[model samples]
Target: MIVARELPVHPQASFFGAGPYPARRAAIAAAAVLAGFVLTAIWSAPFVDSVIGDSVANGLLGYDAKATPIGGVLAGTLFAFVSGLAGSFTACNIAAFGAVAPLVGGQAGEKRRFATTLKPLGWIAAGMLTVSVVYGVIVALVGTRMPQFSTAQTTRLSPRSVQSMIAFGVVGLVFLLLGLIALGLLRGPGFLRRHPAAPLVLMGALIGGFLIGRPYPLFRIMFRSAAEQHNVLYGAAAFALQSVGNIVVMAVLFLILTHATGGRVQRWLAAKPARIATVTGAALLVGGTFTLLYWDVRVLGRLGIIWFPMISW
Candidate 1:
């Protein structure tokens, strides 16, 4: 008979195992997320101003700013999806994703690793979606009660179409420039190339805050439509749908980039990070240019200039 030897297991090796260190880490992550939410709350009131501005602009243009249930949901879903995709490609997320990829894809086999990678990502997505929707609801409730924002009067909100148009044009230009930077066609900040080892929980909170933060001009525009309605539940539902759309896209990205079979692709992407960034940037540039052109045509038409085939979609 032969004696068999067993390998020794370290207590700190597994996060799920019983240990004070793992518990402490978990507590820290939770505290970090809560802190992020509190910071967002502090900025909520200022964001309401943007909401009012957007609503006034739409009303001046003879567009109904009040959001219907179905329309709000649809609009939220589309815009948030785009926002989430763009956010994921940002420096913070890219760094987090790169740091976690190896662990996600390092399981015993290809099939197992892919499945394992999705589990944590799904959890993070759910957490982000839940937190963001809660924040949206809070904004809707607080903004609706404010005296100035209670009514949807275009005159009260300000009927300056020129200013609004200029603002949109500027926004378009900024996105276009950022996109160019991503593509490497234009020089970008060097910090983007660095990968930081941030905790997953902290990253989740950051993502949640980004998607729902009222200070972000783009989100303020999207929220303004819902805010004009002054219905808390409706606004929350709209934002929830938006978060769902964002989460879905994030899941797909996780599936592709961190799967076990994606090692070769990952290596290729790593070797040409600038090239990948460039492609993403170009897409943003095209989108921004289109938006500017659309608005320019609309403004010119309003001024009695003849323009063929007005684009309203």
Candidate 2:
């Protein structure tokens, strides 16, 4: 019989003092958290483009993308928030969850209600919420200011429009490729394999980057349409609400981990990497396929070979 070898522990991997320089490791985690926000802010512009471009490149609602400003913004935020809940269970987020689970969940081995862990909970949740809100705002600010164009405008198959279609297709493939990584079918570069330690900025950035670039259907659906409209308020509001939802859901997970001691939840999370990868992978694959085929459907509609009813938002 073949025996499976256990993975050796890295000094940097231990959250508690079992490893050498435990204090420094904790400090590094804290620093990474803060650094995550800085990176998210710095990369906001390009991130926005990548996200919004994915939407625009896919078919958008045209004039309806701007339909009712007030209602749209409110609805967009609400919907995005709901969507974020589902989107949170990915590798990047799982890393974030694991990173802070020890601190927030505490050293207590007893499993208790989440209310008991409110002290550490407050700080961690607040910071996460704040960073997420900032990320949403940045995306909105950039998305609204981007050049005006729409799927409706691309009905004509001119050279410039053809080029645009090609770009969108390329991005769709990129999303698909990323989905493969999320699903564990592909490995990331070795350096990125390290679990983000604190000041948690890098962890936050990873979450932000994953959320922004993961080709989640909700993001592509909500932001893409909003980006085409150039509605700053809607864009910002939508992202803010989405972030709020994500933070709340993730906070609940943290609380569960902290209070439900004995590390049952954490261990379960760690043990099931294949399942997590599969779920996230499937979602991205479907989303990427939809994004890529958007133009093809639009072209077919333009040719009047197959007519489909427009979605009422």
Candidate with the greatest lDDT versus the true structure: 2
The C-alpha local distance difference test score for the whole of candidate 1 amounts to: 0.42
**lDDT per residue, candidate 2, 1-313, as tens digits?**
9997634232122221222222232333334334333332233322333344333422332323323332455556665665555445422232334334334323232344556456444544444555555655565666644322223344455442454346445544544554444444455444434532332333343344334433444555666656654666666566655555545556666665545556665344344333333333343344444434443343354457566333321
Q: Per-residue alpha-carbon lDDT of model 1 for 1-313, expressed as tens digits?
A: 9997533221112111111122233333334334323332232322333354345434443444333332555655555444434333332122223213223322212233455556566555555556667766776776644332333435333233443445445544544454444333445433422312212333344345444322234344556656666666766666665455444545665566555354664445334333233223333444445434434444455455645343221
lDDT of each: 0.42, 0.43
**N/CA/C clash count, model 1:** 4
Against the true structure, what is each candidate's TM-score?
0.40, 0.41
Assess candidate 2 and give its lDDT: 0.43
